[model samples]
Target chain A: MTRGRGFFPIIRSWSIAAVAALAVLAGPAAVPALAKDYSHIVIATEGAYPPYNMHAPDGKLIGFEIDLGNNLCARMHITCTWIAQDWDSMIPALNAGKFDAIMDGMSVTPQRLKVIDFSIPYTQSPTTFLVLKSSPLAKMPDTGKRVSLDDDAAMKAAIAAITPALKGKTVGVQVATIQYNLLHTYLRNVVTIRTYKTTEEHDLDLASDRIDAAIASTSYFVSTLNKPGGNQFVEVGPLFTGGLLGKGTGVGIRKSDPELVAMFNQAIEAAKKDGTIRALSLKWFKTDISPPN
Target chain B: MNTSNPFVLLGFGPNGWGASLVAGAAMTLAVSIAAYLVGLVFGGLAAWARIAGPRPARRLVGLYTTVFRGIPELLVIYLVYFGGSEALTSLGHLFGRSGFIGLDGFLAGTLAVGLIAGAYQTEALRGGFLAIPRGEIEAARAVGMGRLLMLRRVIAPRALRFALPGMGNVWQQVLKESALISVTGLSELMRAVNVASDSTRLPFDFGIAGFALYLVLTSFSGGVFRNAERSLARHERAR
Candidate 1:
């Protein structure tokens, strides 16, 4: 979900982009010397999305990724304390040195990679639609088919297939998300796209019929889609990934820290090889979300 | 339905978020107080520069007030958090230093909000100084008081009386702006509401609680301001 700074919260589109661009250009920062030891590093997460990173009733952060993140740090011999940062500031905060890294469900989009580096994706849950089951669009064409945005003709064919169903409809998505971007790219001419700061806000609005449909990661939807009174909405539309949707969720880090990147990369590799990622994925998501090798 | 149970959801009782929310509000109070002091330092200097300095110095202070007040508050914070170090590092190398100097989130936030608040405070203080009777300053001059004595004896006390209400409004503004510091991962009132909402998935209850808490902070300060105004004005009888 897109969370950020502001009084009115005007989407943080300009200031964040401009500053992040400037930071990238400003060259090396003054940081403590890179050490061989891995005694401490602060990691951040949004704690808004579930089964990835969300807080338990006692305010303890609990989820599949939290468990795996701690396991990775242990393997790397690093002591880590997690901070729950708002999603919209995760990149800026990381770059600002508020935290050393981010473990939020941040997709590895090319646009994001321009500003921050990522570990190889730990989860690649494809994007899909959640709509009221009573809606006529429930039978939306190409349901269950995986549509990669890189496939030009096939992508167009799928877009054309669902165009009429989405026309004049109001669709909800978390602000600044790839799902929001896709709405602008493919469906802007057809529907009104409403953006929320969190997936849960949109989910609540969806249940109250404030919007006709919403699109988010299937894994995120899984966290709440079937919670009580959630039976009304059914997952619809072709699952999407690639191109604007990017590779999948990864740990966001500053580009200058190749050591941290390499460390996380090895940890993710070890987790995958040992089936730790898959087990945590299944335990939390009821599905395997570990990225394909 | 899981979010419907208000007391258990919002309470600090083991499962409730009662503790975190209180702590977050306390953080908001802490940052706002620090930022207010920063503004006091900047505003005092800027107001003095504007009122007594040479023409060029006055123009520079004028420009400072205009630019900071003109841009939106959020942009100022972004510049502080993201752009501050980047600019500092480059500015560093220009003077022959290498490496990075990172600003902590709380520092960045306090400076940004305080910097903006200082712009308004400068104008308020300047107005307060102008309101002082010019004859009083001449009398101070005739009595052979030096600049510092005049400032401490005649100017400071009077201007402070006039400036309290305006500074009170500025205080409220700073308190509200403290919520924006949440972007830098400084846990405060707004961030607390967000975390609580996401945690409980019940935005309304948390939203109401947040609104009430802000009201308490604002109205509590308003009461203090009113009392301050009365106490400061006590010397002036009803003529």
Candidate 2:
């Protein structure tokens, strides 16, 4: 006989109540707001993803996003405080008022837009593959080519070319990231996919031979490759952006803070216009990832 | 490549993360102490309820312990750390207050580990209470000792002595359980190792270092508890 009143109903009701309550609470908080005077702002970053953001041994936050955020914050005339949040919790933490905005190399995508708003992209670098120099994947087709995922023919060609080499291989990407989605869409069936909390984890795993290849932004891999013992790793596969990779990396702000978003957008635009972004990208990543016109 | 040497990675030099690792160890101690205090409050109440309260109150205590003990510690930490604040904020909304209410990592981790420790501590303290000699209470009552006098003079002393060994075990459990709090992003020993391993790309070095650090912490605490047990039991007759 079924348990009296049933456990399923209790769990269902509990979850339904939770969801409804959250919806009610989240509703008013997310209603887009009018412009407000900028005074101070708090920005969060995942201080674990190198080149984008990571912590120095001295416990200081340093990386491309930190530099870029500071520049933009300066231009916007806002005093900013930075906090390091884990990658998975960054969005929820932002929405929860743990911080005013997120500059953790977050990508701008329609899916994300459903929850939060974004400043116009500052870095539109394509996603690419990084594998050991000796791995079969390192020699996969079109190593130096750039393929836009938005292009139907190029997408078809790139997928067709890389599928065979990836068969039965293990690939790793950070969990809940744009790279995960890209891997899911293109390589899930062909490869055994592993997800990690941060790029550092997958990178470490890749180094320890726990994973066959890793997927992330070329900008990250570029900075990574510059590190000592990095010569052992090589970029693999055609770089991808647009479709699943997102519009590009942008500052994630609360959906309620359209004015904050507007301010960041303006600052980012000026930086792009004046080559600050390009210069920083070069210093940190040794490449210009500033959005191409 | 420069960090390939373990000493270089662990040294206090500019390139080394010695400072962070030590700071992380210190944070682990702080969080553990905070969590232990929380466990003490919850455990004391649960034990009292189980020993003296009505049937329904006892059952509620049972349910609390059962549910917390049944789930994995990692799951408990995640559920509380990630979901608790959201739930609190939602509940707050019903009262017409709005905005996200956040539980910072340290507070969230402490509450979580404390809860799990409370479940264990309840059993330990209850066992200690059960072992208290009924004759002593009777003798105290016969001597016209009031309830408070009996508790202060007889029950508490015997129960605390018996509870020492059990509470020692619970303390150790809480110390180890603090490692699970790392997932919530509290800068504890385990998370420090994770960061260093990732940054240095030498997983084993950091892994072994973390293991050693934890061993040092637990063993040092183990000695303290052992000495405490001896001191607390000094008046008890040798069996």
Candidate 3:
């Protein structure tokens, strides 16, 4: 009788385990599968990227890209939900179907184009260096000038001019960003490059004097410079654009989703033509970053 | 107080993050409890298998515990977040469903933390069962008590008495592990603090707030476990 009773629980336990295993396997199917026709979409962004994207104190997402994305979604006549994702894994997560689209200030570049598709450029901002106001590098050469990296002679001269002030100094850039690639391509040998997970982290390091300089998009710096104690920092050196830095920021979608690419491209064109992008840029970034025709 | 004041920054004002922080703490608690229950299910099964199963079943449980315990918690989270979705998508394809099947952040975090906690839980429960005196089990057999009756009247209660302390440790570990789930983008306590600090550029204030919230959760749970242990010990003290 005891053996029989013992056998009952063993069978019960095994059956319970089997049932649980089946439930987990079936749970994903219960999620309504996506239809090919696009009606509802999910978009991912790095909420830590302020001005472009950041969470309001109320836990609401608000920023330049958030406004632009909503505008574009409305034009396309689709409902969208925004999800906050870490920047490093944004592309991989997009492909994995964690979200259908990415609007995280991701720029369009040749290397990125190889793995994913991007909409036509939406916002264009030049990359530059930021340094402490009291630092000698604050007076870096051609401080207010724009130098297109597509121009070989100008790019070479710009690098040469800044090398003296920057050489042997520690410079910070966000990891996996076009700005990191820019530093690697132009000044890797001259400076000790440090990478951070977020642009904000580099800003903190710069404020603490842990690094001599930090580099990022000028529009991003606009937010940094407006914050408390932001006056202690100043933009320096030539504003670099084009070439390896990519055309501008765009909506990143999976290579498998050409339809999404088309939808975003059309909506972006509408926003640009009607000056919605310009209005949002001026409101959030204090400057217009709408891509030119 | 000025805007720069820590109290003002953490207060429930228009610009303050007190409400969000509390919500995040609540999310952390929800995730921990769900994961702990999942761990108990898996751990109970594995422990039973180790105690009285065939050789191959024992070996399988052994492998499950070893692999989960050996990995870094973050890597385990990444695997469950990405790999769980990948596996589910493949399974969906087998049933003729197309497109990707993604696991949301909450589910992924729960599974990852549960699996890790399950490994430790298995050891604790097995130790509990083993610590049950063989003489008592034999005495139950001598009294003609059936296996189910013996388990209810003698075995389970005693084993639980031994397991309570170890299970409490597992519970605390699960609470801490829930913070790592932020990478999956579930806005738990740690992630909430991170976002608030980064957004406001005041890490110190938000950090302290987060630190206090975690302390309250852990200490509150610790007190509950202590009470449970004392209650479970009451009958023995009456002897």
The residue-level lDDT of candidate 2 at B141 comes to 95
* Candidate structures ordered by lDDT, highest first: 3, 1, 2
Clashes of 2: 0
Residues A64-117 of candidate 3 have per-residue lDDT tens digits of 999999999999998877888888878877777777888988899999999889
Flag regions of model 3 displaced more than 4 Å: A1-32
Q: What is the DockQ of candidate 3?
A: 0.35
Query: What TM-score does each prediction get for chain A alone?
Result: 0.87, 0.86, 0.90
DockQ (CA atoms), all models: 0.37, 0.19, 0.35
**By DockQ thresholds, what CAPRI class is model 2?**
incorrect
Higher-ranked by lDDT: 2 or 3: 3
- Which ranking of candidates, highest DockQ first? 1, 3, 2
lDDT of 2 by residue, B110-175 (tens): 778888888889998899888988888899999999999888998888898888898988888888
* Per-residue lDDT over A228-264 for candidate 2, one digit per residue giving the tens place of the 0 to 100 score: 7789999988888888788889999888778888899
Whole-model alpha-carbon lDDT for candidate 2:
0.80
Top candidate on TM-score is: 3
Alpha-carbon error at B5 in model 1, in Å?
A: 2.0
RMSD of 3: 7.0
